[model samples]
Target chain A: MHLTSVLVIGATVIALLVLAVYVIAVRTPEGKLDHVGGMRLVLWLGAIFPTVVLTALLLWALPAMRPLPHQSGDLRIQVQGEQFWWRLRYEDGNGPGVISANEVRVPVGRTVVFDVTATDVVHSFWIPGLGGKMDMIPGRINRLVVKADKPGIFRGVCAEFCGLSHALMAFDVIAMEPSAFDAWLASARGVPARADGRGAELFSANGCGACHTVKGTPHTAMIGPDLTRLGERRSLAAGTLPPTLESTAAFIRNASRFKPGARMPAYSAMPIEDATEIARWLRSADGEAGR
Target chain B: MNRDPLKWHERLRVSLWTLIVPPAVWAGHFLFSYLWASISCAKVGSFARFPTLFVAGTVVALAIILVSGWIAWKQQRMTGDPPPHESGTQIDRLRFIAKSTLLLAGLSFVAVLFSALPVAFLSDCR
Candidate 1:
């Protein structure tokens, strides 16, 4: 058994026995026994003893926790919790780093320290398969170090109850072998492929460039998510919808239909054919440039 | 400290030191240490601040507990002791209450110390 379990169970049993004795002794004939001496014994054994033991335990635990305030890891991932989605940035030691939204790709067998903060309300960042959750509070950064023992897809979510769309706020984390992760990162940094010029024109004509971004294109804005690799993402609308042509178009037309309180305004006024072409064009470049 | 005659019981009587001081000290330590550590961390961004605050809190809390314990001892000396047979009488009541409070204070002192222990072990404010 773990030392903590043994100590806790042992203490509980001893306390229960002491309580039984105290109850039984108190019920005895009044003045039949010396009160001061027995009460002193109770105070000594039941009160003082436990206090001393707990103090010792706490002393041990204190040192164990001391390293947290100072320790850090090699790989850093800055994750900012926004209104309902996550903004992920992978920083390569002292580098400007690459930015993505709603998804993170990390390498297996390496410690990735998360610099967690919030752009708006307080939220919690949790990758249950990786480790414990850390709060993402506005104006404050919390560091949480996590490592994946093996390659796998891990789901991350906002654990805090922040808003109406809190439960719907989620992300996907893909953990790859070291070399594969490196290769993916290399490709992820390249310019997005420009395939359908007509669709791109339609996207720009509707003012989509004001919020979303497509790398290597004229559509560059910081308000919403970067859509350079939108087609490649596993989910849309912050994990509210699967990455399908129809789903992407639906999300683009009206994100609130899938995720209530989504920040992106609906494009329902745009022509249906234009919206479909744009969604198709965007998703068609998902794995472009072999990213 | 004694302002109102009607609120006499709330006054810091040497007689009731064991009853009041330990819990008061414990609560004070908990609140003050947390507040101090938070403010210090926000301003300093230093890793060493929390442990220092907690260590100081433990020392101060222990001092308060010891003082209360001393008062209990003195009260015991004057009142003789908790009676072996007597259930009523001012001396008996005072002794009983004093002993009870001393025990509670001792336990509370340990609890207050325990509350500060986690900051010593934890590595981050996050």
Candidate 2:
């Protein structure tokens, strides 16, 4: 079915749920909002009826939404929800781990279990086309089961308001063939890390390591997402922009321009020469093979 | 209606339940998970802690709602000298608003708890 049709159907279901509530509300006594008076009839019908219906829906949707293995052999991925972004670390025990930010690539026709958590404030991990939403609550771990039935790109967003840049925080799920996905993962794991040249030297001297991490290097700080496999990621700028050398450079030069209230400081205080050098360094240093 | 001591006591009881249950259930959830994890780690199998916790939380939240309803019943009984105006209408409106908000919150919390069920139960089963 067309995606919009599925949406329409879902909308109809929600409308019915609301209608059920409204019917009960109207039958309720005229005076008080609290006491239903004769409205107990509505409450009984509305609340109880929907409870049964929603429960059925939950059961029906469960298999398609997050199918558990009736037997065995399901892929498991760790999905970490950070303030304003998603850290997708794909592990399969053979590769160096394909660490991508914002966009996640999964094989179609597979059930994937996501171990989700939040590094900062509470955020919800939701990809409507895949399945139900789960919160990324701090100090707690939440799990989501999702399936990518078709090979296509679907938009995913941080459904919970995290902070000033919450609305801008978004990601894409790229469903690919199992072979292609494995290839991508291997390539991402094998991508070599390079020195930032003049830019690389300046990046560290400029104190970017205080926040972001570049694995197998001195910048081991955990304040930000690991940038080890950034080059292979399809989008950058916290999923706000498509991953491109130029966009990545621009974002590094001035993160606040695209994401207002971004936690990362802009290179605004630095001179243009240094800023450009830093941006270049970032582009070069990103996706460099770990030493 | 003067400030009756009995009314004050009743209100206190209602407020105490309202203030207490939500947080208590939240704490219960954490405690159950920690214990479940510990036990599961030790290899002593049991029903998933999450589902059990979910059930417990739901029951507590439901109790809160029923008591709130009972408080409304009590208020109705004690409101001897109606407001000389449409007191029933006014009181009903207030009650509906309060109940609606509470029910909404309670239901949403339960929904989240339900998701945690599978995770909690399967922690050691694997």
TM-score of each: 0.73, 0.55
lDDT of 1 by residue, A20-83 (tens): 9879778988866575677777677767776777677667545633422223446688999987
> Which pairs of residues have clashing backbones in candidate 1?
A62-B120, A62-B121, A65-B121, A65-B122, A66-B121, A68-B123, A68-B124, A69-B123, A69-B124, A232-A286
Chain A TM-score relative to the true structure, per candidate = 0.75, 0.71
Candidate 2 off by > 4 Å: A1-67, A70-73, A95-98, A193-196, A215-218, A244-246, A284-291, B1-126
**DockQ of model 2, rounded to 2 decimals:** 0.07
Q: Please write out the lDDT profile of model 2 over residues A1-291, one tens digit for every residue.
A: 464786689789889978987897689777655444445656666576767766665555444433344223456677787767787777666745566577788888877878788877888888887876888888877767777888998888899998888988888888999899877777676645666477667768878889877765678676676776666565676678866656666777688788887878877666666665655555564443221
- What lDDT would each prediction earn against the true structure? 0.76, 0.65
Superposed on the true interface residues, model 1 gives a C-alpha RMSD in angstroms of 3.0
Candidate 1 local lDDT, residue A117: 96
True contacts kept of each: 0.90, 0.00
lDDT of 1: 0.76
